[model samples]
Target chain A: MTSKQKFLYFIYLHRTGLSVTGLSLALLLFPLIEDNPYTLGLTNLIAINALVVLGLNLFIGYAGQISLGHAAFFGMGAYGSAIATVTLGMPPWLAMVIVAILVALVALLIAVPILRLSGHYLAMATLGLNFVMYTVLLQWDEVTGGPSGFSGIPYLSIGDVQFDDEFRLHYLLWSFVMVSLMLCLNLVRSGVGRGLSAVAGDEVAAQALGVNTRNAKIKVFILSAVLASLAGSLFAHCYSFVSPDSFGIFTSTDMVIMVVVGGMGSIWGSLFGAALITLLPEWVDMFETYKDFVHGGILVLVLMFLPQGLVTGLIDTIKIKLALRRRKNVAS
Target chain B: MLRLENVSKNFGGLPALSEVTFTVPKGQLTALIGPNGAGKSTLINCMTGVIEPSSGQIFFQQQQIASLPAYKISRLGISRTFQNLKIFPRLTVLENILTGLTSEGGDSMLMAMLRLPYLRHRERSLKLRALEALDRFGLADKANWPAEVLAYGDKKRVELARATVGKPQLILLDEPVAGLNAEETATVAEQLRLLRSAGHTMLLVEHDMDLVMEIADQVVVLDSGKCIATGTPDEVRCNPLVLEAYLGRMGATA
Candidate 1:
């Protein structure tokens, strides 16, 4: 492949590489180890969360829409998958498909009204929606198990093959994460990406240029919600149990922090953000008491000194300095 | 051809455009001239469907279009530049012009998403077209530069390049030379004449009377949402009603 093609291929493999390499290294180093299941499962969970965050970044980072209630959509997916399996007696694989579609439809319904709002109004409206969803999950005991959440969720399987163990489920989740990340990268680099940027830059200019800005925003919002829901479903089946706490405002905040700390509008940034935020707490176990304070301080530093987020800001500064040096050389 | 009939716009109780009517012929440059608060911008906004008139009908190509959205109006072979420069700042100069090619089949969201062969071919052709448009406005060298980095006069020209890139049947230029220097104004006038010669119809709203007189085939004078005079530039310049409207209130010479 040409250098450009090689570069793009490298970017595509970067996220999936981390998961595969990490898993392989762990296996090779600790061939006789038996107590590593928790760490392996948690790593898979972080990768899955990164997939969902990638979707959110496409909608919020590229499309410039605020969605604080993405967790509600995530909850819907988990519940939808569980009910499809338990109530309808469907296969877990089929349940996932049904749940994804159901969540997409729900997102469409919610986006139609909420996407009309802009800025802080839209943020507050989505926040209110998450609160409403929490109330419903708390009161709806028949299906959601009220505060206890759902249990006995079936294992995901393809035909005769079942992902029943942590090792098998890690591969499955990583495969989906790779696919999701690739889809997101393609989306943001396409014409829709330009349309989203135009909408974010200036709505009136976008409209005058014949872009259906409202429709574009709503579509991205729904797409993001659907992806989040898919991740939630996988997460539920991974543990064979899911509670209201699994998909709540705190979950949404975690995703937001991932997107923000990594970089707002970059796909790779989302992955970077997810990995760091997810793995940092585990690695910093000694400083457990000051975890929140440290994370908050990192956020403040990123906002104050690197407002464009880590990756983009660094790239821009390098480009600027290089251009200046070239100009100076030419002049001299 | 375009026609506006009995257009009336009211902001609360105050009238912005009241019963304004005019017809612009095909392949002719028509100038809309008026003093401040004379409803010139309001009339352009009404025609472009930016802000709907309180009551009115706008016809373009013998079809009613006042109720259509601004983007739809643009897609129907009518493009316009803003009084305030509205070029996409972060985009390059070429991309700004490419944005104007909205009706082209190659740049659809689906094609862009899939990155189809046809989309790549169209994008290449669009770059060529954008270059031609920029060259016409003497901005070919700056095609790769971010639009935010351009000077004010160059930015105005970029906006014009963007508006005219679609090869629209009619282009509404709002104050195309409002803040331009003499040389820039002359360049814009020359570009407009070239556009006219190339069979593009233009409706210009300009405060530069000299530039208007140099190129206008017909001049329509508006005062407080009413047409004061409609004639050739020379004839309108000599009309007593236009003189009264311009000098009677301001105590200045025409």
Candidate 2:
């Protein structure tokens, strides 16, 4: 093979490594190329959503569990950090860590009962969880600021560096996404990942093959919730505010749509889905007013045409086309 | 290697398996033969901890395992294949085999994420073993293909490869070659002989009488949820109860 061909072959062999390297380079250079704060802010939001989607994909796509209430976990993270840093005077970094742990514990507590359910029932239970959380954020006026939403949250900073602007925060948030993407990619190739895939494919067969389906589901659920919580914290800090409106049932549904549109079992698909959905409103003026209609339309279209999710389906099509072309060349 | 005593399973008021007892000796191929609805599947399910027997004791290597969950029983070196194929359709064939290896020496989800050198080494070794398993079943070339795309006979071979990849103490094959064509059946029969000669204890539930008669060291015949006969193949073949309930007048004419 020529050098270019050899390089492509290497990428095919080590796709995860290529993804990590490519993402790192993009995150580092994208801000330099586009020095617009408006674009930077949207990209930062994409990174935050991508973080949550990566973890959610592990639960939904790999472990075969459903959680439609991730918005609640995201809310818990944001509010948890907001309360700790603003009201209780805790450090922002410390607050983020503590809230993430608390969210994980909460997920573990409810996972046993909620994950016992599958199909539409599981989806409904999680949706109900999002409703309960939204209600609490609205009704608990004493702490959460009620309908007005929580504000005055400060920016996150390291020892000497502060992520005070969109440009600076892009690095902070995308770094989280990059690391999480790497870990998730590593996980899906691991034995535990195989176990998750087994459960997703056939839970009974997975059990027979010695995969602890129940435990695997619960672990991935907690992991997914914790990531959503972390992303929520980052979201709160980036905007310097917390709001019930952002963590409603609609956001949860939108997140699920992102996973479905990205491709269920593909790790890279998570980032693709998050970016596409996050940018949709910016690209189309009609998106906000018809958000539900557009989201539903995209979902229906994707399901009908690309049932395996956009990225995976596209890749499969390209592969088939390439193979057919190669066969024709050999025949001639 | 496995012993079931007075194992009876009831669904609602009806009994599927009643007072069924048999022993699968170590390093022996035990063919479980019976007519339709004779409770052979139920007996396999009970032994593998898929379902709880209403009243019975199941011992594996002299330890009571009747109440253990399927995964725990699998961890105890017992593995099984489903009567209907349960291949992980989306996973690659190699990954399907790797799933079987996870019951032993597998890392936790957290440990896997860390990607430590030792864990990477372990993963590489495990992949090698999975590839070797695929080679054994003539599926090494298709290791990267999604299992759902494989032909029916190839899917069955994948299931067999998955079951044996873990090197379990006892393998309960629900119906290894049930729907296979003659060529596939002969290939599977050869694989069984290879597994047997390698000293793996197997409890095969199959309807292919010739495969069983050729490879089985012992045969246990069940009729209507009861053990009708158990002995060497020659002995079970001559038993009038087995001939009547399963082998029928065909064996008598032969």
Candidate 3:
């Protein structure tokens, strides 16, 4: 195949089957070695969280917007779905759908005002909004169950199939994660992605080209929020409980770090970041007492040496050096 | 055709463009020439709806367009290039031009969200058009190269390619050849001549006297935010008022 065709083929395979194969391989190996469901359950949670991070990558990395309150939107989706299922006695699948739509609407409402401001001001606005959301989630006792959090959330099911067991939920979460990643990949490859890149590169230029910069920002923000909410709902159903801590400031920061460390503007990088961030704590648990120190040290090193994030920085440096060598050879 | 009547702009009591009036005829290249701070850019801004005039009317093709936004004005068959190069740095040369082609004002939100096949087809056609634009500017070979890596002259050429890719009826070129070497300047001038031959109407704001004299069918000289002279390039070049505005007392004698 020609190089271009080869590249496209690689992208196609990576988009469609790579995740499926990875999940299948993990499942095949998972049962033979381990019987513990807790480890598998946590791993599944990480995979779900990674999908949410992938969505945020589209907004934060590709669109170049700061979102410190992403977890709040995720929390909203979780709680929205939980409330719909428990309080309102709706079916789980229908409740999830309603929760996604409501989360997107809330995101739109928030974006209308916040998108007008950019940079640090935008960051602060999102951070403050997240804090307010956390307080509301805590104080709204009757519906949300207050600080104790919501309980008895129904397990997720579609038709006759139930995802109450750890393995079942793992496969289901993986399915959604793959779908979200594929959607994100396609979105970035489209004209909408080009517009977002233009806005990120230079807002004024994008405006001069007749791009509605404000509207684009709002749309992407809402899309990202909806995805986060979907993950939140899934998480709530998986655990059969919902809590304020799951959608707190720390959770938001964790998502941001995942996207940044993996690579900004790259969906796959966000996945890699999510996987590493999620799995590293488990590996460090062997140290037990020094787990936090090891995690903190890794973050510091990653930030200090690879500020553009790990994946992109390495790729750029290698490309530059190769380009320089090619130019020298041409001159000779 | 474009006309600006009684256009006035104020910055908290200081006048930037006060009662400025002018008309640019259809199918001709008109030069807006002025010394530093003569409100040349401000006039362009007002005409393009980047700044709202305090009291004035703008007519493009005899239609009132004074209150419209910049993008809306662009969509209505008017496009512009900036004084500072504004090419998307990370995008490829062809992609930059494709942006101009795909930037119609009417794509629906549903279409954008769904990634409709028709939009995809339009995008493919735009890419082909972008390639043709690159070829016209002698940049077809560099179509895949990142815009940021191009030299300043090539970047300006790419910028022009982007602006004109939409095939707009009227194009506003703000100092198109600024900061170019003589060779690159000649290339740009040749391209402008080619554009003019293709029956494109151009309103150029340029400081390159030789280029302006060579390409401009008509010249409008502005002094202190008002048009001081309007005539053919040679007529304006000889007019005492134009000379005085450009060089003061010595200009008349010279």
Candidate 4:
């Protein structure tokens, strides 16, 4: 290969790494460019949502599994951390780590039976799990603070550096997002990733090819839950609050929408999906009463025109346009 | 290397296959031919452990495999292609072939997630192996194209490449050339012969008489889920029961 061709090939092979590095750099510079706490706070929320979406996409997009109960895991992380730090008097970082591991174990227990159910059946089961968790958080009044919500949660810290404000919390949250992105990218390019794709494409075929479809589904399900739980911990620390209302069925549904709107099977799509969905209401604040109506209308339009999700659809459009231009040039 | 004895399958009191018996010798192409509803598919399903047999037993390499799941059967050196195309539509052709190597190595999910050096080496080696398989099937240039985008004939070849990529001890091909044109059928026939020459044991389920007669080392004919005749192609071709099964009794008499 020519030197130029070799360089381009190298870039193609490492595109995932390059893009991740670029996104991390952009994230690091965002706070420096904009000192507005409100914007940074929104971005931090986007990062937390993206963290969950990245893992969820692996299950939904790659492994071809459904889950409507991720909010439960997220809530588990928040409530677990809150209870550990406030009621049980554990350190903030220790609480976060311990809660994430506990939530993962809970998810594993739930996944074995639930992952057996596929399609809408799986979705319904997960939805039931979310409702169950929400109920527990509400009825367990003394511990969870019930409908009024839990408060007095401590800010996360590393030695002396405390994430007390949105600006400081932004770095912590985005770092998690970047790390998760890198791991997820690494996963999809590996052997297990190929097995997951095979399962997603056709479960029977995957089995015939020696892929344990059931096992693949359960593994991705647990991984997705752990990420959501970690994000839940971050959500609690960032806001210093926890509420059953925040981790209800609606939030779970929103995460699914982000995965779809961002594009299935595309990692970068997760980030864009989370950011767009989270910011949509804020952007359409002028039409307060018609907020949901406008949101539904836009989603319908997007699905109608770009069924592949925003990132993938947009990328395909650009490629097509470029190809057309190239053909015209060649003809001329 | 594989034996079946009195394997029967019933669905809701209706027998799809009844008391079927056969033995497939290793390092040879054994073609399973039958009329419609003759239970060819049911027999294949039983052999692959897609469904448990209603009665009797199946043995592969001296191990009873009737109760094992499909993946376990595959891992025990049995692989199969589908009647209808089941290629991973969204995945690239190379990735599709890589999936066949799942039972071989690099199975650590944690190592994959961590992007460890061992997995990186495994990925590269697996990719090279997949590319080699694609090359053998004449799909080398289209390795990066999504499996769905390939033409019907090419898709069949991709399935063949995938089934053989892992170098399984036994391959069950169901209508491998069902939708292909004459030219494509000839291509697949050549690949099958190559596999036979390489000493791979294959059970071919096909309807095309000429291709089977041309390439099969042994032919087993089924009529109403019973083995009517089994012998060399020329011998089975002249069997009275086989003639009666293919043509009606009156036609056979004529």
Top candidate when judged by TM-score against the true structure: 2
Q: Positional deviation of B99 in candidate 1, in angstroms?
A: 2.2
Q: Local distance difference test, per candidate?
A: 0.81, 0.89, 0.82, 0.88
Instruction: Give the clash total for candidate 1.
Output: 0
Residues A1-332, candidate 2, lDDT per residue (tens digit)? 99999999998988778768987997899999999999998999899999889989998888877788999999999999999999999999999999999999999999989888999999999999999999999999999999999999999999888999988998899989988988898888888888888888888888898888999999999999999999999998989888899999999989988998898888999989999999999899999899899999998999899877898778766655554465466459
Candidate 3 CAPRI-style tier: acceptable
Clashing pairs in 3: none
Model 1 scores a TM of 0.87
Say which docking band candidate 1 falls in.
acceptable
Q: Which ten residues in a row have the lowest lDDT in candidate 3 chain A?
A: A318-327
- Superior by DockQ: candidate 1 or candidate 3: 3
Could you say which candidate leads in DockQ? 2
**Candidate 1 C-alpha error for residue A152, in Å:** 2.3
Error of 3 at B42 (Å): 1.9
State the displacement of the C-alpha of residue B176, model 2, in Å, after optimal TM-score superposition.
0.8
Q: Which residue pairs clash within candidate 1?
A: none
lDDT of 2 by residue, B1-254 (tens): 89989989999998999988889999999999999999988888888778999998999999999999998899999888888999887666888888889865364888888788888898888889999999999988778776766779999999999999988899898989988999999999999899989999999999888888999999999888988999999998889888888797666578
Scanning candidate 4 chain B in windows of ten residues, the lowest lDDT window is B245-254
RMSD of each: 4.6, 2.3, 3.4, 2.8
